[model samples]
Target: MHQIEKETVLDVRGLRTEFGLAECPLVAVDDVSFQVKAGEILGLVGESGSGKSITLRSILGIVRPRGRVWGEILWKGRDLVPLDEAALRRVRGREIAMIFQEPMSSLNPLLTVGLQISENLAAHTDLNSKERKARAIELLDMVGIPAARNRLGDYPHEFSGGMRQRVMIAIALASNPQLLLADEPTTALDVTIQDQILRLIQALSRDLGMAVILVTHDMGVVAETCDRVAVMYGGRLCETGLTADVIADARHPYSLGLLRSIPRDVAPRTPLYSIPGAPPSLNALPAGCAFTARCPVAGPECRDVRPSLETTGRQRQVACHHREEALIHFSAREAAQ
Candidate 1:
């Protein structure tokens, strides 16, 4: 049986975000583009300073005042780039919501969890205080918080890290958003808790039919949770494709490097692979492919001319001058290992 195609909930095209002086601003996100369909989970994976978080902020029009954003962020066919705060507010939290990376910082220490959830209900829905309280308890229960009504009045600090993260998820779902932007939702948690949170998010996406853009640095998480993956480096996307395809046979050197770096079930005392060199500074990005310095297969052209993202196969795109060579070269090496 053929699966039905989902609606496109978000379409981002040529997204660029910058900060600093207009004359020589530092580019944080450069010409990044992707789409999210309803009931799909897209993983945005990269190392620190790869602009994955910045890309998410740009989509929601939440970049700071000093920052500038260009290109299009179409949410349900409506352009969000040009929308003012007033207009964006109508869509934010109600139609789309975000689960920030750190629940401790994102949640208010002064306010109770129930009040925070109710605040969203008050803003987006016409529910009265009595009804909002009821909804808040229901949300807490939905997120697996035990004694939901009893926990409503508890302050954020009173909860453990995992529980606080659950509260954040509950709050984000208060408005029952169609789209959810999760920024490292499992960060700073123990492995067991991380698995639990990831499972919860997956279940919520399935049950609610909510589209998700999950930002993280873990390839393992992407492999486990995402339907599709986008790999970023130096503020630009290097690869985008279905998760299984990208993981099985990465075409870009950067993507291959990331996959290789993941630890496997190997003999004891085996040295883990690590990608060489740190990412380039945003203020001093190269004119050509940003990964050229670290890329093993880089040529003169890779150092002098930038590579545009080009289609390599069905639903797969790569920005590389030697994508075909990389595929052949890496495949042979992996097979021989």
Candidate 2:
């Protein structure tokens, strides 16, 4: 694997996505902001409907027509928020590519595997039919597809789930994209295949110097593969920092709850702890902290004021009124967990 140059590849600041409704707007992404440097893995984690997928959609400009967006999404120093349709199209697969969560639905069953990959190459490059075919074969091989040259005519249904996902990754990398947005990229695969795919992504990001933003709710995956981890709650970023720090010394109550709920591998019989309350609906969120309802540590102060992202003892940034001080008390126990 090649070394990545030290630099920031993508920066998102104060991003908010709101869907317009009859009398009220639904805020799907609420003032979420973060950055991904070149050649690093950043994990965006939250349960379903917590806006993890919506945040990725916001970055891709796939929000509904009635949605309102606010904030800057800078890619390679250019703000993608203001880009026109044509320009965005040109940039989509070339500079920034994405691998969908459902690999089966993502690929066209009507088109052969080679045709799909070659189409992307043909669209972006001035390559002849022969040249495009050659590039497609190479991409398939690069993505670890066995007997790659002979599979050009195979349709989506011919491949297994893992192989289809490998094809999706190959298509996303067809243009040698600088940044790859992987939304639940390995969710459908079995454990062995999941690890294999994650390893492949890690290898490729290192080899190609590509920045990766992975969306998943699995804390174990984040701990294993991410350079940094960002926890989202109620459409907002609740915490973000180096994976080791965030996993070891989480500073927010919600984050603590998430960590606790995961089954420990070493201590096989340890009971799984879960937060009691459900997550808040965006339309009817509390006036103060959105997580206050489910937080065991929430106090009168937690319900009175929303906390900004503040630096903590571990140099982690957490959004909680008491995180900077009180959360550290649980840090040692969490690390041992």
TM-score of every prediction relative to native: 0.97, 0.92
Q: lDDT for model 1, on a 0 to 1 scale?
A: 0.94
Displacement of the residue 204 alpha carbon in candidate 1, Å: 1.0
Residue range 1-337, candidate 1, lDDT tens digits: 9989899999999999999999999999999999999999999999999999999889888996778999999999999999989999999999999999999999999999999999999999999999999999999999999999999999999999999999999999998999999999999999999999999999999999999999999999999999999999999999999999999988899899888888887669877778889999997789999999998789899988999999888799999999877777777866876
Q: What C-alpha lDDT values do all the predictions have?
A: 0.94, 0.87
lDDT of 2 at 313: 54
Candidate 2 overall Cα lDDT vs. reference? 0.87
Candidate 2, residue 93: how far the Cα is off, in Å? 0.5
Using TM-score as the measure, the top candidate is 1
Runs off by more than 4 Å, candidate 2:
1-5, 265-271, 313-315, 324-337
RMSD to native, candidate 1:
1.3
Best by lDDT: 1
